[model samples]
Target: MSSNRITTLLVANRGEIARRIIRSARALGIRTVAVYSDPDARSPHVLDADLAVALGGTASADSYLRADKIIDAARRAGADAIHPGYGFLSENAEFAESCRRADILFVGPSPESMRSMGLKDQAKAIARRAGVPVLPDAEITGDDPTAWAAAACEVGFPLLVKATAGGGGKGMRRVDDLDTLVDAVAGARREAASSFGNATVFLERYLDKARHIEIQVFGDAHGSAVHLGERECSVQRRHQKVLEEAPSPVVGPELREKMGATAVSLVRELRYLGAGTVEYLLDDRTGEFFFLEMNTRLQVEHPVTEEVTGLDLVALQLRVAQGQALGIEQADVVPRGHAIEVRLYAEDPARGFLPTPGPLHLLEYPERPGLRYEVGVSAPGEVSAYYDPMMAKIIARADSREEAAAALASALDATRIHGLVTNRSFLAALLRDPDFLSGATCTDFLDHHQNLLDPAPATPTVVHLAAGLAASVSRRRAANPATGFAAPGFRTLAAEMLMSAVWQPVGREPIPVAYRLAAPSGDTELVLDLDGTRHRFDLIDLGADTVRVRYDGVDYPCAVATHRDGSIWINDATSQSGWVPEPRLPDRTVLAASAAGPVSEVPGTVVAVLISEGDTVAAGQKLVVLEAMKMEHPALAGADGVVQKINVSVGQYVDAQTELVTIGAEGEA
Candidate 1:
């Protein structure tokens, strides 16, 4: 075995994973180089690295997915090794081979090992050979729709058309019947081509009720490998894992050993090297597990396993890449306590979990014991439309699963994220859910509990009042000199003339607040009238961005922030909310503009135009499809109408609220 060490490591990825790899490499005294697209020039990961290289494009195809560009960057940066951080070229066998050709160590398994498990069909076949149980599946070999449908039928009803080249729930579609099978296959192929550069896909029987259990495996050049228990990632949306935990709630020690041994056997058969995860689907009713696929790179949810086992998987990968021996044996491996991780994404749960990329006016995570934050973006930064919408991964560890879940939920509640819609509230709600608490979670967890996807309960009236008062006070403070204050927002005609302002909570109607400030000295009192109702509050203290008030004898402390766009954000002990100040003079032109037809909800590139000008469409019919952050979102017609104009075309980039199709009622023109 060679004794070469990685001195300068180049991370060939972006976002949290890049930052994560840099952290581990830095701790080991390795200089890290970060590669980024044009949009990620100033991203946190790029800034965190010791050196940065620009790939010079906005989209992944033009930047991150360019293997040649990455290889060039590594050579330019004089990197000794390249770490593909769990996406993009992380599982690309050709990229790994390119690294090998360049004589730069790829901190992962062998390229041959990757190819052996890269394709789902091939991997399943290999698993069967290794005595690992696999689900029934059929490979899609041709472009013929009849052949594809025949393969689906062979796999049976309610099957999944999955891309052979990628993970992370991309390039996959579920077809329940023959009618949609062809379209599903076509969509999956397109998505797979876009994401993995491989349009090849296969069919697998869908498991409606199953637990996603993945065994983390590690191997070295010296022919030793061990499994680091399992992580249950059943809490998902659109087949994408949202929450993950270590030591699955359903697996006992015996089952864990059996699964782990089975996973280890497969890796050992391939003589796999570095960090890898062998995923499996454990049937909820049958208590049987089937090999799903093997991710030839570090998994996104590796932190949960790290938290429970106290092992740095990245460090291990680095060591393995250095041709080192597996320092510990299977008998030495032990997992303790429990760890839970939730992916905090810049997305709207109420709106089909669509990605919402925008400025993050305020991004703050509560500091507490047992809480670990792997943040990808920063406040004053924007979630670019070019990459994944995940902002951070929040993990909590405790003595038991219940405590870990509860702590994570509370921490999420305390986290202050503003300026864009997110799934933070939904994640917290799911964590605190009774079924989740009881460990009764499966792949269909979100499907069965659809209520969690709804918008969070409206911000309480008191919170809104506090935000309004805070905004008013801030405005007054800024308007008046520090020494000339006669109490913030105070009027000389005090009681006779109350200050009024209009505040609107997000997704709610405007509310008018008429408030009077009292007590120029101590314990200020606020009298507020809202909707013909009066309420009184005792103002204990007011800081730059926080307010402490006594409403109905209950002390409420709220943290408030105002965006550059005049939007106010408030976070209290229970909930977080955002408010926009109603303009004093509404724009008549905007009010007169038609609010009709289908519009893009997020910024993306139009991938498909399903309707042309003058085409008659029914309600809920997909008129256009936009691809953003590697996910497809269709603009559906709101009502039956004839398309008046097709404003967008394929390959056109658009912003949020950009009209894609202008539809008019029949004979309206």
Candidate 2:
């Protein structure tokens, strides 16, 4: 039985995935409705849908996760079906069952199938029964402090404490010793509760060096299932996948067949429908693999799969939801070429990938064939703390892995995002890493190859050019052409004199620049002198933000924008950086006696105050842990001293560079 019954489909998610689903549904002649929170009212997903509904909530719990509100919105819009794209209530069994009872089609597996493998522990049990390999794990029970300690002892040291109801590396932590075991479990529980509405967790042996591989499996209303090729998602940080590719370099034809078969067997046992992914952790040393968990929904990296297989997975999902059968056999699904994908996020790679939320003053993405951009952002938009910091996903495909990798690298270079710090340069460096190029990728790739994540240093020439641009922008509103005019907010000087300015880039010392007006005539040109060198440049104004500068015998198209930090950002095709007007005097309040106090590098809430006033702390001792954008960062005391002042407690939200703890010098206090 086959019927394309869906005429109007409502997407209950936001960001890139929502936009992705809407595109696919529209291609099949289905009208799409989008539900958005308050912060996402101006997002691309809202504007992409044929009909938009406001959920009237800034947070996810009140908006997307509210099953009743979503269902009501769907009915109000006269929608025939609903699609939960990956996050929010996508895998909530109760929500799926409610949809079935309401006689509304859900573009996913049946509720029974969702509950079968929704939790990690339950999924492992089912996999074990289906003849798939599984690892030994301890399922944690109710609220006993001693219970957590006992479970950790049983699992041994170097254990992984993960949420049973969560993914995306949100509610997972590692316990290295007895001292941090209790705290790790408690933190994981709190994060799990905040992320998945479930505090249940389990303990398992942590593999330090493992590769993550997943098999894509799809089923229909009829009892039929097939597995697409496997994808390698080993390059990750903090338990979240950063980059992914299909047909892993390490897996040959034989191993690929074996993994696919194992994944399909699980679908046969559960009779799963719609789209799903079976994840496994492969031991790089032994070439053996064990089932990790099964995602009961479409994934964030599905574009890479579509690129290689030449199939529209979202279309298949909609067809299956409409009671369509498997019209093609497994032999018809052959993966050709290679594909790679990278997630572009608004995060500071220099600060441990901390989330940096701000406006997108300038946004330009690569547009070309064989390169797909699944983006859900636009200029003049803010990257809010209310949801994930993902701005877009750039995917590339070619005949070989090297070609695909090179294409993705080129695309990243072509992307330009100003006004907020991002991991763009870090992603480019990763593609060029020697180990990555040699296919020596593992889960700890980022950890072991930390040098690859460092932000590139801006060349001295670029900094000088940026300095000139900054100075010129500050004086853009000059009163007269021939006579030099004073600044509007400042007192006028009797005689026109040369102006001096300074430039300060992050992680480097400040630079001083002396500049004088070149002429009183047509195009304004300035002569800048820095470090005993003089350079002259003529500026051609083009609108307010973008400028065309003729310098060094070439015309450069540069965008000048101000940052949240009161710094000026200058960007071009070859370079992008943030520069601030240098201060004349060094602030003494910013430094401690030993220069080792704990300060927050990112804005976050104090989740744990591990130290108190008057407590003796050693070097490298954890003072507090801050939670921001669903990730935890520990602020450590860098020197031996006593805690003189504790400025933060649990639940106190602080801003970047805010002093959270003050450690007294060893001889004082």
Candidate 3:
């Protein structure tokens, strides 16, 4: 065992994971350094670190993935060790070796161990040798399309073409039939090469109904290892885990013990160290589990395990890296109540979970018991298109799974995030889903339940009234500072004239609101007319962009914020909505410029231009592929037509709503 102590550590990562590691290191009296890309220079994680170094690039390829630059930053910061926090070279065995050659402690497993398990194909072989059950798979050996088809035939239909090098749902494609097998393999290879710098892929049998269970395993240099427990991560979208909970509801004491022992056995066999997760696919039909791949680094969902086990996983990683023995054994491990975690992403669930990268005008989390937030960006901060679009991880722990699920769902509802679209409401809906609450989740949960992606319910009239009042009150207050003590909209004129304004709520038609200030008596009263109906309400300015409206003896406190584009966002007790005031005169030029074409829904770099000028295309044919937040989004033809013009080229950066290809009528010049 080595006696080297890590006094100063550099986190070779950014965002919430980096901040999380810095928090743990600071708690241990160790100073932390942070490395960031150009976009993350002013990020919360960089500000939280004792020292920060800029790598000077916007994309991960030019910045975070530069192992040489990261090591140099560590050396310049005088850091005794480097902590690769989950992505961007975290599982890179070559990077671990580089740290060793530089005499810097890598706060993870050794290079040999990483190499043994970094690739899925190799990891499955090792797990099989260790007597762990594994599914049948065949590696793509040659470029021959026929050979690829043969391998797919051997594995059978309804299989997955998965990248051997990386995890996190990247470089993975599900092919249900032979006709799409080749395209799936090609796409998976391109993605794998882009994500992990490896194009190698393999075909694995896809279980129709499977529970994605993973065991958190840890090992130390002193030949000690332990399994904290298992986490259920079956709920997914595009093969990426959306929610995770500790102590899976489906696994009882006997099953948990069996899986935990298997995980620990693999840990011992590989002599693994630090935080690692052993992923398995439990076939719901047969009640048997098969080895997937082992994540050789800390998982994004590690917080759920930490919540239930009452352990600081980052602290454990640090201690193990310092050559300290894991004092606790398998028997010492005890899991408590249920804990659930959901990844809050800056994406539009209604739009196929497309990445929505933009400024976060307002980000607020409800403060409640048993609720934890591991946030990456601050309000008013930008979610760059160059990186992952995940904004935060919200976790809740309670005595039972039911309680935990309810608490998380409620907390999500109370969260106020504005500016760009997000999957907040979708997550809340999923948590309250009957199947999810009953622990009947599988890898295809989202696929089977697409209704969750539907648009939120229409904003209630009460909410709209509250929002209109709040906005009017704010404007009135700003206009008359000297009359701060006076009632808002209190016109001295005896004639009560109605003020009219049209407000358009998102995903709904325009609403006409006519209001007039009533004669103030004991309290301020505002009279409102909606759809030829009249109502009276007592309005009170609560200050700080908040207003309280009393209707039917109930007080509703509404928080209001305005976007730069003049959109008004209001959050009331029951719901939140964004309303844009309709201009008395609409811009005809802008409306006329909007034409039918294939446009990008989010900002991204054009990776492939599949169509050219005058090219005839069918409806739903892919015309251009845009890469944003490291994921490819294909812009498809809207109807059968000839491509009138191709406006974008490969590697060109485009913004949301930017037309990539304009399709005209068939035979049109």
Per-residue lDDT over 527-549 for candidate 3, one digit per residue giving the tens place of the 0 to 100 score = 77889988877777634367777
- TM-score per candidate, chains pooled: 0.93, 0.86, 0.91
* Model 2, span 1-669: residue lDDT tens: 133499999999999999999999999999999999988889999999999999998768789999999999999998889999998999999999888777788999988899989899999999999999987789888878687788888888788999999899977998898788777788898889878889999998877778999999998878889998899999997899889998798999889889999999999999999899999999999988999999999999998899988888999999999989867578888889999999999887776777887778678877877899988788877888767888999998999999888888878877878767888878988887789988999898998887877746333355435434534444564534532353322223323455777776633357777765443455646567778787777666533356666677777777766654566666666566765566444532344333548788667778788877889999888889887766777888878989888988897878767788888876676
- Model 3 regions lying over 4 Å from their true place: 1-3, 455-462, 473-544, 549-555, 563-565, 583-593
Q: How accurate is candidate 1 locally (lDDT)?
A: 0.86
- List residue ranges in candidate 2 displaced over 4 A: 1-4, 142-150, 153-157, 457-499, 506-567, 582-626, 634-669
Clashes of each: 0, 0, 0
Pairwise TM-score winner, candidates 1 and 2: 1
Q: Candidate 2 at residue 467, lDDT? A: 39
Which RMSD values do the candidates have, in order?
3.0, 4.9, 3.4
Better of 2 and 3 by TM-score: 3
The most accurate candidate by TM-score is 1
